[model samples]
Target: MSAIDVRALSSVPVEPWRNGGGVTQTLATHGTEWRVSVAQVERDGPYSRFDSIARVSFLLRGKGVTLRHRASVIRLAPLTAVEYDGGTEWDATLVDGPVTALNIMTAAGRYRTTVNPIVVATIVPPGCAAIVIALDSACRYSEPDIGTDGSIQPGQFMIVISVDRPLRVEPAHHGAAPPLIVTIEPVPARTPDSNF
Candidate 1:
């Protein structure tokens, strides 16, 4: 993987849910290993289940949403994220109106995932396997010898690859939705058959 993979916000095909709950747009993916996407929920409905996967999701727009799991419930508000086992059955209830959720799914136990809101200029987590999404304003980045430099347009995203170096992320401008930095690092799961 390269240091940065830039992608503009373009009109991509919308994938409507069979239940007519809403639509979804996949922003980027790395084979079957992991995926980044945005989902818009128009009406309360059940969330899709992904066995053997771990999910970390946050609200991108709208009022907020409530996630109903078997034993507990979760309130998903703007700037807040929720992580849970993807295999769990869950239902969504809109609070005030429809909401858009940004989600990252990675095969369970295969990778370590982190989603952080850009509060200040910071380095891209080591390994450089991350995704940077511009929320309210364009996101800027700088790194020596790195192929990417400039502002990522609002609503756009950059898929970073393996670049073992420091990648700095500037804080979003005032009055803009803070950008998100999602990092995914491979962590091979040990098998019982393997020697200790």
Candidate 2:
């Protein structure tokens, strides 16, 4: 089991010519089965349609963006994630300023994820996975069994632990800042017939 420090995430520019929006990739199929990317939406952009992918977008900074899908419009707020079919028509409108968000996309039938806040002393059950992000500048995490202990500053995110193991979360230390946790689950495997 390994712990991924969110602060260490590398930033890659989002090429609109390629995916219809500006984005920064943290992790993807290159290192893991799922793709994790972050984007900063500055203005109205083209609607994105990914026929074979599933995505969850979490608002990180600013007032957030207005997500338009077909005839539906959803207002996403900081600390909340909106899950939708990647193949559907989707667009965004920045509310007050440039909106920052964490986007997780996985090829269909590959993986799924859950994003939420973790209060201290919470024992994340086995088979449950999570990504923890520090919403402030002084948040810390500790796991006794895994020998994992660290802190996350404001604007930093960590991919806590993979789906292969169980996890536990402790509340932030006194004066510890707020944070967000996201859990991911990989799709089951498909076995091929040897006779083929």
TM-score of each: 0.86, 0.72
The whole-model lDDT of each prediction reads 0.80, 0.65
- List ranges where model 1 is wrong by over 4 Å: 1-3, 145-148, 188-196
Q: Deviation in angstroms for 182 in model 1?
A: 1.2
Q: Write the per-residue lDDT of candidate 1 for residues 70-98, one digit (tens) a residue.
A: 77887888867788888978898999999
lDDT string, candidate 2, 1-196, tens digits: 5545556443434444354456555543325446666666766775467788787888877787887877888777887888877787777788878777887877677766777665555555556456766555445656657677676666566665554444555555546445667667766677785442
Candidate 2 is scored at a TM of 0.72
Error of 1 at 149 (Å): 2.3
Looking at model 1, the pairs that clash are: none
